[model samples]
Target: MLHLGLGSFHRAHQAVYLHRLIASGDERWVLAGGNLRPDMADTLTALAGQGGRYTLETVTPDGTRDYEWITSIRHVLPYEPSLAGLIDVGADPRTRIISFTVTEGGYYLDGRNRLDLSNAELASDLDGRTQQTVYGGVAAILRERMRRDAGPVSLLNCDNLRHNGERFRAGLLEFLERRDEPGLLDWVAAHTTCPNGMVDRITPRPSPDVAERVRLVTGRHDAVPVMGESFIQWVIEDDFCAGRPAWETVGVQMVASVQPYEEAKIRILNGTHSCIAWAGTLAGCHFIHEGLSVPAIRRMAMDYVTDDVIPCLHSPESPSPIDLAAYRDTVLARFGNAAIRDTNQRVAMDGYSKIPGFIAPTVRERLAAGQPIAGVARLPALFLAFLQRWHRDELPYAYQDQGMDPAAARAICASADPVAALCADPVLWHELAGDARLTAAVRGAFDEVHTTFAGALHG
Candidate 1:
């Protein structure tokens, strides 16, 4: 397998799973990983120096800390402008699976589910000038594999996006069509399979203390150590074209349909996560645990799930088999793990993407059913408040949003009716962007957020 986006989450989740399989005497699959961009150069260098080995630190909510050496990654290909190493490995027939963990916004799809050409990277990739985007990188690899007649491969998507594999395949196909590569597109349609998969692990960016702790526990000075919560889950659709690992043996759920799992996680877990991050930042809390510590913020998350998402996802007429209530509690408990210390900044960075992907679906569902959206309303309301702080440069930390257009966001913030301006953003709300019901609900919730959390806001 060749994996892209060698980030901390991939290290903690996917790589850890593969390590378990390899440790269990199934060494048929080994990961050769690299990044499309030059992210984590220092860590990649450290990992390569250690022969593609690194330590993983996991902490349970009850304060149980553990460390293990992960050696599933056999090759850490160095990043070059041309992506020669990645293409070579991906084009190899033996490399049956190619997985990636690019974040939600990285797909560059607009509300209409079409390729967003406004993004400079996608534009360049379409022009065949660079392979910086996921579509570009994967396309280049597939084109080479076709040229070399390297047989079929599975394109696995390990991200939080709903129907991730299907969505990514659509984006890739659209990209190929625009590039006028009919032959390459035909080859990909015949030879590649994109399997949707859900990945979960609360991996925080490694702090310096993690390295120190790793050295203390493992008696090794490991530089590229990763830290994550003890809780982990992965549910994948069993539709690999070429072949796949026996991930089921390692507690991975290989299901025929990943829809139920993806919807549950994306809404219950991911949506609540964003709520806490935004509300926590507003309440002057630094970590997710700290946000959960605040009764008001915690209540908002609970109510959002109980009042909106659960009802929308699982109803009386057609009930879901999964124990959604238990799942909700488990997600909240995982978020409340103080030892994990998941930062509000990291969770709060991608609000522009989260609003549509995580929050808006509930809003859309509830509104369609003529139900009150008060609970789900709080999320967007909190985001509006957070964005105001960002606009005023009052946030304690920097905000990062891949999907946000700086000029457009600034104009919205500067507008006389900022709430209305925000509610009208098609990128964030899609067809419901300027809906009066959405604007009204968000406006009311905005007021409530200020009044209800007055003390926290001031703090």
Candidate 2:
């Protein structure tokens, strides 16, 4: 397998799973990992120096810490400006699976599920200016694979986006279509499969202390160490065109449909995570555990799930088999793990994407059912408050949003009626953008942010 985006999450989650499999003496599959962009250069250098070996640090909520040396990534390809290494590996017939972790916002799909050609990166890729985007790099690889008569490959999506596999395939096909690669499109359709998969593991960015802790526990001066929460889950659809590893043996759920699990995780876990980040930031909290420590911020997350998301997901007519209440509690408990020390900025950076992907669906569902959106309404309100801080340049750390247009966001924040302006954003709200109920509900919630949480804001 050739995996793209060799970040900490991959190190902690997928790589760990593969390591377990390899450790069991099933060495049929080994990952050759690299990134499309030049990121984590220092970590990559350290990992390559150690022959693709790294230590994984996992901490349970109860503060039980464990360290394990992961050697699943047998090959760490060096970053080349032309992506020669990645393309060569991906075009190889031995590489049956090509997986990636480009984050939820990286797909660059519009609300209508089409490629957003307006994005400069996508435009450049379509015009053959560059091959850095996922679509561009994958297209180049597929074209070469077709030329090489590589038997087949599976394009696995390991991200938080709903229907990730299907969506990515759509974006990739559209990208090829726009680039006028008819033969490539036909080859992709015949030779590859994009399987949707859900990945979960609260892997935080490695702080400096993480390396020190790893050295203390493992008696090795490992420089490319990664850390994550003890809790981990992966649910994938069983639709690989090419053969895949026996991931099911390692506790990976190989199901016919990943819809139920992905929906549950996206709303119950991801949505609540954003709420905690936004509300926590407003409350002057630095870390996720600190935010969960605040009763008010915690309540906001709980109520949103309890009132809006749960009903939409686990309706009386079509109930979910998973014990949602237990799942919700487990999610909150995971967030409350102080040892993880997940920062608010990391969770809070991508509200522009999270608003539509995570929060707005619940709002839309409740409003369509003639139900009150008061619970889910607070999430957008919280984001608006958070956006105001960014607009005023008051945030302590840099905010990174791949989907946000800075000028548009600034205009909305500077508008006389910021709440109304936010409610009317088509990118965030889609068809319900200008709905009066949405506007009014968000207005009430925004006012509540000032009135109910005035002390936090002022403090």
Clashing pairs in 1: none
- In model 1, where do residues sit more than 4 Å from their true spots? 455-459
Return the clash pairs for model 2, or none. Answer: none
lDDT score for residue 36 of model 2:
82
What does candidate 1's lDDT look like per residue over 216-242, in tens digits?
888999989999999999999999988
Look at candidate 1 and tell me the lDDT of residue 421: 94
> Which 10 consecutive residues of model 1 have the lowest summed lDDT?
450-459
lDDT of 2 by residue, 1-459 (tens): 999988999999999999999988899999998988887677778899999999999999999999999999999988877889999999999999999987767899888999887899888888998888899888888899999999789999888999999999999999988889899999999999998899999999999899999888778999889999999999999999999999999989999999999989999999999999988888888999999998888888889999999999887899997889899999999999999999999999778889999988899899989999888999999999888888888887899999999999999999999999999999999899989999999999998887756875531
